[model samples]
Target: MADETDEPDSAAHPFTRLTPDLVMDATESVGFQCDARILELNSYENRVYQIGIEDDEPVIGKFYRPERWTESQILEEHTYTQLLADSDISAVPPLIIDGSTLHEFDGYRFSLSPRRGGRAPAVDDLNTLEVLGSHIGRIHAVAGDGGFTYRPLFGLQEFGLDARDAVVAAGYIPAELMPAFDSLYDGILADLAALFERVSVNTLRLHGDCHMGNVLWRDDLPHFVDFDDARSGPAIQDLWMMLSGEREQQQNQMMHILRGYRQFNHFNLAELQLIEGMRALRMIHHVAWIARRWDDPAFPRAFPFFDSERFWSEHLLSLKEQWARLSEPAIEIYD
Candidate 1:
């Protein structure tokens, strides 16, 4: 329930222009009757809402952040989700109106989807973890059939160096912490690059941000939502985020996940080596994501810990620890 207008310079926050009236008009523009009841969902990168329609089930309306993605990239995501649905995968595809999934209203691009609800999956449950793994495996099977020509690739230059640059450029690090931040960040990237050179894995279209939050569970089944982050990346990029706990516990979890994974598609165990590297990239990218969106009112509210000397100090320490983990042997799964 944070105010979308909390940013001092409102003009810098594009979402501030997206008033409720505009939302209602946008829904009606697409031939859906609005009941004037809209609940803003939990999202900062883009504005999302559950809008009620007269005489119909409420629909989820997602307004894409302007200039963030090209039309081709958005359509590619829609096509991918539709393909998943066609294959009987539990994914929600954008609703097609007037022979198109993407729609424009008042200069903003948006998509509508039927409202689907479920609680977050219990990833710690071995059975649930395997099921989730199988679902991702099936999604990957379809993804590997082809490549995304327009989507960006997940690599050190994009997720690591560029991310670090964004933070520095934004002037987020306090003067006192700049040296520590720069030194630690440079070292982390160097270690990550060395690790990447040691192994090569196939990159495919992926759920991209396949964390537990993006998955919804119902009736003991898992359905994925939010492919906004979908891109070309290693299969392990989709797998590493679900793991937690001590190294031994994570190893056990990976075994169960791969057990379900291999049933659908051949998983390259070599990709296991990329786990910690991918983790480091995500850590860097997350800070960059926040830094880039700091002008948005929601970001400052949600990530109050950012832009502080203490936060950067701890972040440096975390990267150092991760660098050590990168040198250790990758997790192994056996029959």
Candidate 2:
């Protein structure tokens, strides 16, 4: 048996019933025989496992968080990824069984996918980024075929305004830091609203969270995974997170990425203005996400610094910096 402290409480968490036997049974229920070995993967919002199959390669089992997404919404994600795979874009989609990609066992909705192996794409290499950019542009080209019927849009209302409200309402900020937090957050939100209004761009289904962790590189190319965060948003939402380092470095990075991006789809120069605005929105949303998930045992273990005076102090400092960045001109991307 696993140590009590090391595992999330079954009663406190939905995964209480998710045992090794249950996982094997779930995988076998679809047809394959399990080898009875289950390896828990690192995932917070949902439980994931790599289960060995009898006489076959291992498969990935992803159990969805209860009530987080409706059946149709999950299907939308599956459909999009499957479309990408069929279109020859390097993406992983769930395996289809009995004409369905999604299946449920023991009251938990789950999906199985053949595991693809790769390391993180070299984000700083201009050549590698150019390759990844072309793939993303192709992904977006397919995404533009239609809008999501269920997934939400990435924008100010949810990521910015609601996030700011949730933070203040949670009372996580130190009493001494409340004024600074509020004042800085308010200024950021106001500027965010103005920036969104100033720069109007078309929206398309996006990878949503295109960070390095979600990408795997093999054969000198990129393979995208975890479209769980897929939603409708400006193209920059997909491009911005891949950038790192100082302003000049990010500018060069964007230039290379766009070089590949523009080949498949039109690149809007005006949307460049929203990069810092998007950053600000993400900062606010991150705090709120942590606060909302605080009740989950994994959250405290992962973010022990949360709700502390020092944490709020540093957060406030970051917000102040973001406020300044929000005021400055957006990162320039020369063609």
Candidate 3:
């Protein structure tokens, strides 16, 4: 005799459907409550409702299925989250469990922080870039010594990109890129390893996943969320991801972030360049991971640039057209 209500909702994890009752139960029975509405699901992440719905909760609830991450990954997030909060920086902070340890539930990692309040201010928007750059600089300014550490978020073996490697290892490169795959991955791996080695490893907490998406405009100020990837690393490493999206000469947007970071930390020209290389690495690593996830329906159409093979080719052509516009070479950031 089974009361249907007593049975756990079957839709809670990957390959499973999660019902509203399930989220309710997880919130009520586990520790806290987040009145969130299911908004949308992307390739590897879940974005729930936010914007002060359900009794003044300022943020959305992002619940990550373990299929997408391990506990260690979540723990690293918690570490940097603490650093941000401790340093008085505006970063997403995970709610604590029993006065310590971030709350986790449903075999997934979860964080409920202020949703960027409203629409994201674009990088091209005037005043937006300056603000974003300033905020970013503030974050970077609190470099190496300020409540951060340097535990590698991605390891040589478990870069969280193993799936991508499988595809390439199986010769999955696009027809046009076939000959380049071997050399590219080899070069990327070697470069990452060398940079990883020579960079004087140090500990400084940072918002692990820093990028345009992680920033939003709320009350005319940039509100950053998604500290799930927070960890110990060169403080400058945090800024590189956002910086790599664009180059230095045309990086007023980046300069705002850099200047903001400078309000708290300082780096020499060489260090800044090195950090920029790190950012490029991060992009390559993620682009690889995204390629492997092409099977997932929600994966971005053609991330890191385009969505389809045709679009990809077009993008390459555009890059060629803009080749002169690209002034600097790249290194590595995250992967």
The per-prediction tally of clashing pairs is: 0, 0, 36
Ranking by lDDT: 1, 2, 3
lDDT of 2 by residue, 215-319 (tens): 999998899988988999889999888888988898899999999999998888889899888888888899999877766777878998786788888888887
Models sorted by TM-score, best on top: 1, 2, 3
Q: Using TM-score as the measure, name the better of candidate 1 and candidate 3.
A: 1
lDDT of 1 by residue, 1-335 (tens): 12433454657667888999999999999899999999999998889999999999999999999999999999999999999999999999999999999999888999999999999999889888899889999999987744688888888899998999988887777787778787888888998888888788888999889998899999889989999999997899899888999899999999989888888987889899899899989889988999888888788789887866678788888888888888888898765
Q: In terms of lDDT, which candidate is strongest?
A: 1
- The whole-model lDDT of each prediction reads 0.88, 0.87, 0.52
Question: 1-335 in candidate 3: lDDT tens per residue?
Answer: 11212322334425244455555555555444556554543326453533234565544556665455565666666665566668886776666656644455665455655454545667666466657667766665543554423344434344523633654553334567544544545555565566556555444666767766777677778777766566555555665555435454335445565555555556443345455345444545555565545444345433523333554345334433333232355432221
Sliding window of 10 residues with minimal summed lDDT for model 3 = 1-10
Question: Which candidate leads in TM-score?
Answer: 1
Q: List the residue pairs that clash in candidate 1.
A: none
